[model samples]
Target: MEDQRIVNNEDYAVVLIDGVCHLCQGLTQFIIRRDPAGAFRFASLQSEIGQELLRQGGFDGESTETMILIENGKYYTRSTGALRIARRLRFPWSLSYALILIPPVLRNLVYRWVAKNRYRWFGRSNECMVPTPEIRRRFLS
Candidate 1:
């Protein structure tokens, strides 16, 4: 699928995450809650569209080492992506974007640790999350 088919650059940002990771799914839910305006859309890293997006971003589609945020025609990965997502969230949550000043090399060190151990700590789903009917529009097929 084409990027435009999933998200219009001016209308929404796309978050690509590990489909079966419990933590990743929870993070999506968290963002949805904080973003009443629904500025973000989601897809699993394992999905075809996600792979295509990854390829377009010059990444290996099979790499699920970090979450990705596609916004304003650019792609950010690791802590930078997380911080950029936070910057778009509501009030107190948006404050987390301040952490961006910490330097990505330092920030990503923590992000990588959590990502590497997420499945062991938070467990995993047998399949990708199926969005509930209420939020179905926020997810890409």
Candidate 2:
């Protein structure tokens, strides 16, 4: 197991995703690609660091269907997390934040559907993603 790594309450955001889900890995890569400024760190939802962040945010840390964003001691989940993270990205991606005006119930319905089918549709990794040497520091252990 990776060590129990902890993220500090800094300006940087921390994202938690299902480690084995292909869609999640792709999303993480997309974030890294779009955010050249290195504004976020990442951990698997099954990781100790991810659990700690969930607990700190008052969530039970068992649900893995939702993306999570931890920033400045606050946490956002589901569509909110997705949109908030998008707001930090570049170009057309940042435009996604405008969707926040949509009702969350409708948005989360779509999110949950995609999340539920992700592994089936996109496959899964046997283990968490291994960040490349240059980006390794942006991933929590």
Candidate 3:
């Protein structure tokens, strides 16, 4: 059997996303495309790892509405998490980190608005999309 790897708070960034949301899955695909260096790892909010992390971070899984980025033991939610992930991405994609300059309040307002309607606007998936064999290692199922 493959050994289970325990995530170290400092070495990896854990992305918490909705396992059944189409928009969330698309965003995960987008990140995978841009993160060619294997800089990020993903976990569905419905997964075991995702649940553990959310509990550790004091997040209520039932009401989670934003993606979470956990880095170096700290957690960033909403736009902050999105921007942090962008910052770690490769070249042109990393440019999106610049959005950090916008005030948090403003950024979060936009993020929350989109999050609120994401299900209605983008729909939900019956299950998380399966990653290709090549990139499967990056996902924490």
Candidate 4:
């Protein structure tokens, strides 16, 4: 599958994250910090751009159950998406890709646990966050 991986230079990567989830917000920020070159762009799963991408990618646009990564056109979700994001990030975090060896079912179990309780643990925003001006360029309005 790696052989089929398309470099995302021409097509900016878009990450669809749950808008109100604090954990999702933090993860987006983490990716932004680790990706200074701006290799990735972000959208709230509820946003128009995000919904359009989800529909185009053959996903149920309203489902906020998992993080989605759209790269070059193809989309990845769940644990696969997280691992792929990690692969594009800087060192230490990039090391997370090694977890992909554990099998997706197992990896996703942990991811789902966190996502299921994210609101309880991390709280949530009443609306999608407004990006600070410095990072506004990375968000797909």
| Tens-digit lDDT track of model 3 for 1-141 | 211233454556788899898999999999999887777888888887788878777888774599988776678999999999999988887899999999999999999999999999999988877888997998886
lDDT of 2: 0.86
Looking at candidate 3, what is the lDDT of residue 112?
96
Compared to the true structure, candidate 2 yields what TM-score? 0.91
lDDT of 3: 0.84
- Winning candidate number (TM-score): 1
Q: Which stretches of candidate 2 lie above 4 Å from their native place?
A: 1-8
Worst 10 residues of 4 by lDDT: 1-10
Instruction: Look at candidate 2 and tell me the lDDT of residue 103.
Output: 100
Per-prediction TM-score to the true structure, in the order listed: 0.95, 0.91, 0.89, 0.90
Q: Please state the error at residue 117 of candidate 1 in Å.
A: 0.5
The best candidate in terms of lDDT: 1
Q: List the residue pairs that clash in candidate 3.
A: none
lDDT of 4 by residue, 1-141 (tens): 221232243446788899989999999999999998888988888997777767767788677989998887678889999999999898988999999899899999998998889999999999998889999999877
Displacement of the residue 38 alpha carbon in candidate 3, Å: 0.6
Candidate 4 contains a number of clashing pairs equal to 0
Candidate 2 residue 117 C-alpha distance from true site, Å: 0.6
Assess the local accuracy of residue 141 in candidate 1 as a C-alpha lDDT between 0 and 100. 74
lDDT-superior candidate, 1 or 4 = 1
**Each candidate: how many clashes?**
0, 0, 0, 0
